[model samples]
Target: MITAKNPVHAALFLVLAFFSAGGIWMLLHAEFLAIALVMVYVGAVMVLFLFVVMMLDINLERIRQGFWSYLPIGALIGILMLAEMVVVLGSRYFGLEHVPQPAEFPAGYSNTKELGRLLYTDYVYPFELASIVLLVAMIAAVALTLRKRKSVKALDPAKQIAVKRDDRVRIVSMDAEKK
Candidate 1:
């Protein structure tokens, strides 16, 4: 997805990746996360992303021209990330011996219930902070895109309110003509 040349193709590939990750999460018994990944990320977010990508008037040639120049730096970052992942996954702290097994839950126990409890009780502040950040981002996006262009004709409420009856209606005396 990252390597996809076309932005739309990249978005589609990302959707595929989300679906795959959701499947992996389902396999790991994280049903809430898996469903949220598929429904929120894949269904809603990806659709909006694809719409934005398609609507954008992008110069593909210009974008591709810089790819070769930035390749080395991108490769370096990718390699570093992969190395970090390997180190974390292969470290002794995360090894089978060091990792504690999950406690056995009764059939009535719901992971979703536990997740909701943790989210609302333990991690409420961080979750609310994240929501605030998202709200600010949304407002910022709107403010940034809302430009006052001279070409666009807009009504002024003050001017409209100040108008009198004569300003809108013109009366002229004329001789009546018979047709």
Candidate 2:
């Protein structure tokens, strides 16, 4: 019996609650970590979830028709994702080398400051590339949504600009009819 309205409101409330707690966490000196978590999850992931929910229509029966057909592919994708996570997190277990930790900083050095410095100095190119990729994606999305319809009457802006006011205006006067 759960409807769309209930789930949408619940998700909005959850996101609001998360941001409220995150703001408090930031005040408690975990500013960078808290903001990053909020930005990545609440900002990006939640917006993506909302976008997909609003854009796509789902029919349970139609979807269920292909459940068995896609089960093996879905399972394979899931296993690959899990395996990738294990490989990334299990580096120590696999005897891979680790970078030596830097010497402890003085009291004034903040984690956020250090992270920013590293990102700007070492990862700046990759960061710029990511932004360019996002821009291209946005442009592609806009282009995909734009279509020309033959049946619709559309105005040409260039023609409008070239037109004189007299061409579009007409004046007429009506007098009482003679008995």
Candidate 3:
């Protein structure tokens, strides 16, 4: 995806990456997380991304021109992420000996319920904050797309509702059907 020239292809690669990560979660017995990852990121987010890429008029030439200018910042971000990952993976807690395998649950136990319990109870504030952030993003996207265009005509509901019969129609008495 890093080397993909097309933005659409890059987004598709991201979907593949999400699927792979979800598969890994499934292997680790995180069924709820795996399904959530596939459903939310792959099903919803990637479809939105694909729609955006298809609808937008992107100039490849302009993108290529700005590549060099963006490279430095991109590389800095990549390096920072790499360093963070390395630190986390190299931590003692991540070692096999330090990490214990989770005990198998009974057949009737539901991972989804447990996850929801934890999310709504212990992490309610963060969950609400994420929802607010998503709501803001959705509103911002709508606002961005609703830019004023002189060529496009729109009706005001207030004006429409305020109109009286006398304002919209003129009655003609003498000029009626002089066939």
What's the TM-score of every candidate structure? 0.71, 0.55, 0.66
Better of 1 and 3 by TM-score: 1
Prediction 3 TM-score vs. true:
0.66
Clash count list over all predictions: 0, 0, 0
Say which candidate scores most in TM-score. Answer: 1
Please provide, for model 3 over 38-126, each residue's C-alpha lDDT reduced to its tens digit, 9 standing for 90 to 100. Answer: 99999999999999998999988887888888899999999999999888888887754553246656767777898899999999999
Question: What would the TM-score be for candidate 2 when compared with the true structure?
Answer: 0.55
The lDDT, on a scale of 0 to 1, for candidate 2 is 0.75
Q: lDDT of all predictions, in order shown?
A: 0.89, 0.75, 0.89
lDDT tens per residue, model 1, 1-179:
87898899999999999999999887666789999989999889999999999999999898888888998999999999999988887888865455323465566777799899999999999999999999999999999999989999999999999999999999999999999
Position 12, candidate 1: lDDT: 91
Name the runs in model 1 displaced over 4 angstroms.
95-103, 143-179
Superposition error at 27 for model 2 (Å): 16
**What is the number of residue pairs that collide in model 3?**
0
lDDT score, candidate 3, position 121: 100
